[model samples]
Target chain A: MLLEIKNLQASVEGKQILHGINLTINEGEIHAIMGPNGSGKSTLSQVLAGRDTYEVNAGEVNFLGKDLLDMEPEERACAGLFMAFQYPVEIPGVNSTYFLKAAYNEMRKSRGLPEVDAMDFLTLVKEKMKIMELDQSLLNRAVNQGFSGGEKKKNEIFQMAVLEPKLAILDETDSGLDIDALKNVSEGVNKLKSKENGFLLITHYQRLLDYIVPDFVHVLYKGKIVRSGTKELALELEERGYDWIIQEASEKSVVA
Target chain B: MMSTTLPTESKEMHPYTERFNQLEASEWALDPSWLNQLRRAGIAHFAEKGIPSIREEEYRFTNLKPIENQTFDFCCGAPVADPGVSQVQGFCFDQLDAYRVVLVNGQFSKDLSDLSGLPEGCIVESLNEAVRNREDLVQGRLGTQVKVDQSSLAALNTAFFGDGLFIHVKKNLILEKPIQIIQLTANGDEGSNPVASHPRLLAIAESGASFSLVERCVGDRDTAYWVNSVSEFFVAPNASVEHLKVQEESLQAYHTAAIQAYLEQDARFTSHSMAVGAGISRNDIHSILDGKNSEAVLNGLYLGQKNQLVDHHTLMDHKQPNCNSHEYYHGILTDDSRGVFNGKIYVHQIAQKTDAIQNSRNLVLSDRATVNSKPQLEIFADDVRCTHGATIGQLDEDSVFYLRARGINEARARRMLIHAFASDVVDRIPYQAVKDYLENILADRFDPKD
Candidate 1:
């Protein structure tokens, strides 16, 4: 298993957001988590990424046969756990190329490999920029500063391409993208997917899944996964709103 | 303003006053008749004002006890065999084809300076030479801009200033390259007593002339010295001047400098000052828009760590109508350091249609670090627009996590954000060499081990 979360329970500021979340993923598998607003979709992603604000009350997250919760955010990233933020930060004065090179060199240093030279690194960045259809001028500008919503999302995927990870979790990557941007982002993700890597895509709408099909889809309601099914489950949920699943979960809780 | 009489008793006299009285009779006081008169007037003014104490409103946040308690011998005619020219060559703008003036230990080094291809009718020489040759220019504008009665330090500097740069750009002449003035201070001997140097600079740009000036101050890191510098600029009508001042003295040094500019009608002036060194430093800048439709912009950035204390005080006086002024200053404090910023914009009653804005931003990187920011605007004109604001904050947690999730360590992420905060002021600089030099210094400071 690439990632295994058993009975995950987390909270923020003393309010429990994730009561219990249990999920599993294997190599080369693309798992889509579809949920309505305030269904703990983002909470799950933040908890897995080791965000300090969210406290993991009780649960064990194992990644590649090691405890994922025991490592820092950067350590988790170096250990092949990458997370794409919903709203990418705008860091002024930090050039895009410089930041990426530093991150890439750090990862290489951790893996006991020699550092990449500036010329080689530039070539690699240029090649990856083509995959995301990013402007070459963006390399000279500050990181995400003055970039449009669609460009910001594309930049996230571009970063994922640069730093190849074993398990990647993208939280609401399709929130603010246009149709063309959505297609471009989906295409970038599809090209990076391989048998050696896995993806856990947390999104709200089913439109994104149409471009990049998922092997399995799960319905998250009120901090718990109410039901799990195959790819068809996403289409069913898209056609009929999430009221039915939410109503069923409450009724089941009363009966129990 | 309150006026207090000076004590007559010798014991009650300020230490600096006593030092000035003794130094006034020395042979170094020999100069032209007008220069001697200027020095005498400076000493008399300093004697009455003495050293400014925290009791005064202008010196409320800064204490001069450290400077008041100790006595620093003046360095005069000190022969420096080698002023570490090669070491400073790396810090200079050698890539740019420009005339260079190098001053070591408050004395000009003609051998190290390169003034070969200066423009015709332009004067680039030492202040001592200017006092002898161009007496009319030196006597007309040397002590007119700064008020010696208000600042005791300025008075002291006027009385004891030995040698500095004298730059004059003739009327209707535009220079192709910027002029770079580099000042390097070092102890006369290893492990010697503390020394001090007061360098005075006077730059004049005639009407219809344009030029750029870059002044840098650097010192030996291991020495304990005091550098009290005063600079005055005279911008004639319709002339434009861009000034860049970078102060990177020793960590154990005491630096108190002031720059005052007088702008005539339709003149344009912009200054960028960056302070990154000294244990305790204060920079005072005052710009007076005495001409109609003149514009002035002041930008500054200061970075402090450990026990360093950095203070910046600026004043923009709109004395004429249809003038505009903008000021932006930022500071980053870490460890137990403290930062202070106080900016004021004053518009007179006759100065109608004046537009002015002042903003100060500070980022505190440690729990113990502190910053005090105050932006004041006083407008007596009914048809003026004046706004001022200040903000003190820490690095945005969201920004930090964003970088961390991208595989950057905590320390590096914090440094990147701090650099971003400082770059806002640095980006306004037009000179490529100055920009590159500041960026490298910021990088080295953030990642010291590297």
Candidate 2:
């Protein structure tokens, strides 16, 4: 197994969000998690990404034989963990290239290697931009400032290319994209996927799963996973909706 | 105004008050008629306004008792020589080609100054000569541009100003080199209260003219003194002016300055005020847009260390249509120091289509360090856009740890982040020498253990 979570529980501000979650993933696998609003999909990603606001009640996450929960957000990035945010932050007056250089340098420092300078970093970023089909001028402008929704999503993919993480988490990356943008974003993600890396794609709609097809599908109702199956399960759920799973989970708790 | 009314300190009634009051203006009666009236009016206004109280809306952050307690005698004899030009000197400009004016103790020094590179039609003289020879230029513009009633310090400056620089650039003229003014305050005898001096500066740029002015103040490192300075800047239509004021006085000194500016149609004014020294310092800066299509950019940085107290108060008034203004200020405080920043931008009903933005950021290095900031915007015009923000916080711990985990020591990491925090304001300054000097000073002041 490449990524494993056992009895994962978490809370934010004295309110429980995630309860007793269990999942496992292998190399080169794409896992899609579908849930309704406030069903704790974003919270799971944030907790796994090591954001300081969430408190883990009971959980153990082992990634590539290391304790992933014991690191900072930036440290998690350097340790081959990436999270594409739902709402990206804009750092005004900070050049996009400068921010990327600093983030990349931090990653390199964690791996015990010398960092790249300005000239070399620019040369490298230009090649990565071509892969994402992003405008070159975006590197000189402020980070995530005045950028369209699609452009911001593509920039997140470009950052993933620069950092080269082992586990990439996509949190609602398709919410704001048009058809053309969705296709381009999918192309970028397809090019980045390899046997050495795995993906945890979280979305509310099954429409995004059409382009980035997942090998495993899980239904998250309320907090815990109610059902798990192959890709065909997503098509069935799209045809039938989530009323059956939520009803079944409610009945199971009553019987217990 | 005296609600708290603590018993007055004995130092407030020092002996020099009687002597200063006795030496009336015998020399003013021999001067021009208009100048005498202006002086008398200024004195009358000062008497009415008295001193500023801490409860006043405009001066809520700046106290004036320290300024009113000291007595400033009029140094009216022949110009004093530049004292210790070689000691405590800054970046030597010996090889640079420019016009330089030196002032010692609020008096213009002729023997130790040089003004050889300016154009033919430009005028650079002392305040006395400017009033005597160019009465039209001096009387037509001085004190008419600023709102003196809003600030008691400006009123006092108008009343007590003795000697300073008078610069005028003719129409359609472009100065190839900058004009530098050096104001120096030297140490006096022991056991005496810190002497006070008031220096005045007036600069007028004609239509289609452009120039730069650098005003710097320095003094002995361990002496106690007070420097009250007032400068007026007037930019005519289609003109541009860049003004830079640097205050690096001794730790035992008290410094205060008030800068008033007026901009006409299609005029541009860019100014930066950097204060890095003095035991107690206060700066009052104001700019007014009096014509259409005018723009102003104001930036400032104040670094306070130890037990020092520094206050910066600014006001930008939009009185006409189609005008824009931008202000950015940042402060770094360490130890038990205190820093205050109060910026206000007002848009009148007639000032339509106005756009203004103001922001102040503070970096507190210690638990005991404190900063008080208030960024306000009052707009009466319905068709205008205005926004203001004030942020008070310390360095991001994650960013610091990220840098430290990258082989940078904790000290160097803090320094790098502080420099990054201040770089936005520093990059807006136009002069290279002034920017470099300020960057060096900030780096030294923000060191981890400083």
Candidate 2 all-Cα RMSD: 5.5
Instruction: Evaluate residue B300 in candidate 2 and report its C-alpha lDDT on the 0 to 100 scale.
Output: 86
**Lowest lDDT block of 10, candidate 1 chain B:** B1-10
Lowest summed lDDT across 10 adjacent residues in model 2 chain B is found at B14-23
Tens digit of lDDT per residue, candidate 1, span A1-256?
Answer: 9999999999999999998889999999999999999999999999898899999999899999989999889898988999988988888888999998988888898899999999999999988977788987887899999999998889989999999999999899999899999999999999999999999999999999999899989989889999999889999999998989999999999999
Write candidate 2's Cα lDDT for A61-124 as tens digits. 8888888788666667777888887776554555678777877887788789899999999888
Error of 1 at A19 (Å): 1.9
- Candidate 1 per-residue lDDT, tens place, B1-450, comes to 122343445246565555665665665556687776777777778887776899998888888788777677776544564766577676587466667888876677787787898979788888978888999898878888875674888888887777778889999888878888788887766556677887888989999888888888888885678888888999999988888889888888888988888999999889888988988899998889999999999999998888888989998999999999999999989898989898988999999999998989999988999998988788899999888889999999898898888889988898888878888999999887778888888888786584
Assess each model's interface with DockQ, reporting 2 decimals per model: 0.74, 0.10
Per-model root-mean-square deviation over C-alphas: 3.8, 5.5
Quality class of the docking in candidate 2, CAPRI style:
incorrect
The positional error of residue A76 in candidate 2, measured at the CA in angstroms, is 1.4
On DockQ, the leading prediction is 1
lDDT of 1: 0.86
The sequence of per-residue lDDT tens digits that candidate 2 reaches over residues B66-171 is 6567654445333443465454245234443456777777667665567876688788888878878888898878777543564555665565566677889998
